[model samples]
Target: SNYSEEPSRHPSLKINAKEPFNAEPPRQALVSSYVTPTEFFYKRNHGPIPVVDDIERYHVSVNGLIEKPKELFMKDILNLPKYNVTATLQCAGNRRTAMSKTRTVRGVGWDISALGNAIWGGAKLADVLELVGIPKLTSTTPAGGKHVEFVSIDRCKEENGGPYKASIPLSQATDPEADVLLAYEMNGETLNRDHGYPLRVVVPGVIGARSVKWLDSINIDSQECQGFFMQKDYKMFPPSVNWDNINWSTRRPQMDFPVQSAICSLEDVNVGRKGKIAIKGYAVSGGGRGIERVDISIDGGKTWMEASRYQKPGLEYIADEERSDKWAWVLFEAEADVHSNAEIVAKAVDTAANVQPENVEDIWNLRGILNTSWHRVHVQVRH
Candidate 1:
């Protein structure tokens, strides 16, 4: 709607979401750490960023299938035991541009700029649900129970021509390890309006779109949320299905993000004539499986070297509360001696041993959703 607002600027990058003020630093700028500074983090908003000027009056409703429906204000939520998590939020369509290069796809034309890592602070969704009580399925309940839907205060017209809201499965919502949150702060500061001021749902390991912005309502149901965004949009399709032959119903909406990694620097860009060229970037796997190792290859898919990894300290909810492994992106680096032109590639393997798909085409979908192809860049060595 209102795209005229001048977004806050980052010293590093080009701003993409002006009203919500979304921006991404250049690839080289991402090589340093796992926790991306708030200013340099990428933002993805689906509607005019809702501004919450009054925190005291802010209320979040937890309704639907519970015996006691509760409406909690800001103070009530803050009164609970506070917890923090270092996690990464990625748009389901982060690398859509790369997919577009192969075939024209619909939706936001995002570059690699739709992803970012940050330390999210809030009261855990699990804790909140425990206080209010999440309804349990009974003998009379249907065989296939689906999800607990989340709705945002912000609304927009959908591609299928109606209002949009986002949701996630009940299992993900109730899992203590999911570390879903009613996040009120980002990177240790009060949430900015563009980033969901009073409250927002932080669904770790799930796509960013499902992490609804603006505090609103939570409903538990046996069927998926009927919102246009969940039912019609954000669905994935087989590569064979072209725009002309698209069957919307045949495609399933994207849920968990796939294992993915990218090389943040290239050898020829700024490497010395005779020194180690450091390759760095972040690796993450959706569904809470921590990334185990990142493999780098100078000659595209040939020999590989394991990159050194940096793990941030904190409680990683996605990896289970008892587990010490970090849920945020793992900063990885490797040094290699190069003397000629080479096609450098990087791929990550998660604890589950789920590796990134070899090529974009192999996992290419009609909508360009979940484009986690191996990250590749070409470089030339100086003599």
Candidate 2:
């Protein structure tokens, strides 16, 4: 296992686990910058990190349902056209801790910082697929399959000590708007070992699990991968089912997540003489549906103030004429009047008009995944 060689992690991250190395940056650190620094990026590992001492020898095998099954070395990938994408990667279980507070759920307890946005540099997955003889996507293409499976080099205990694996629908893999990439650089620097050095897939606008790290191989198949992560886990169920009655196969894996938002202003701040309290936070939506607006409520939903949105300067999204690709989270801020005390709440609306639930109970599932409820935090306002 590559556990022994894993590099030292950032001291600022709040450690959730020591063995698998799950950690998230503090809320303050997360909102401090538009693009999260590589060191501050959240690290979510399910198993041992595969050590690649000699990157030149490392190769990613692409096969299954393609005319030319080929082995792409680091040099081969670098030779292709380089594309830059700015997107946020959020874990499916990002707010698991908040959900656990409502009811018992099994998984790593992650804080709000289990998400980050970065500028990625790599070759487009679609270009690579076509180069390997996978025909250009058409209404009738992908003649051999409907899914693209990605396997990781890391050995995982979750799969009973086997290599980790996951898959996405072929449509998402081939869609030019998806901006899927074989990323070699993060935030303008060569990827660090912790962040899938040498090579990894960056599936923008999807859950972090779909962005397989230490990428080992790619295969096109008739159906989604039957790997443990793709089938038995990372799924959502209605609150009605419990451990005894729940059938893992009955539910489908979670793909694009629901509209979500979080508040970053938690510490008590003095209301200035202007009688306005400053509020700031982050908001995001899945599946390329950009956040239309983020509403902030200071009086427990009686009234709301819309927050202004901002992102990394000069970053362009990959989108077609029909729509804009909004894969990155928007940093927002607003000011509202407050006195004595108040319950601050935040909710976001996606471009598709999908709004976050007002309360967690309304959308609570068996596993506490996809908690896109309005984030609330009480603050003591001083004169």
Candidate number achieving the greatest lDDT relative to the actual structure: 2
lDDT of 2 by residue, 1-383 (tens): 45687789888889998778899988887778888888889999987677888887899998887678899998888998887788889998888898888888888998788998888889888878876776546222345677889999888787988888899887777776688999998887899888998788999888888899998999888888999988888898888888899899998888887888897766423333435666888999988899999999888899987889886543334333322237889999988877657888899999999999988877777777888888887766555
lDDT of 1 by residue, 55-128 (tens): 67778887766666789888878987676777788888887878888878776666665777877778877677
Question: In model 1, what lDDT does residue 260 have?
Answer: 84
In terms of TM-score, how similar is model 2 to the real structure?
0.93
In model 1, where do residues sit more than 4 Å from their true spots? 4-7, 17-22, 135-146, 159-164, 267-275, 314-325
Provide the TM-score for each candidate, comma-separated. Answer: 0.88, 0.93
Candidate 1 RMSD to the real structure: 3.6
Against the correct fold, how does model 1 do in TM-score? 0.88
lDDT (Cα, 0-100) at 158 in candidate 1: 64
What's the lDDT for residue 113 in model 2? Answer: 84
**Per-residue error at 196 for model 2, in Å?**
0.8
Q: To one decimal, what is the Cα RMSD in angstroms of model 2 from the true structure?
A: 3.1
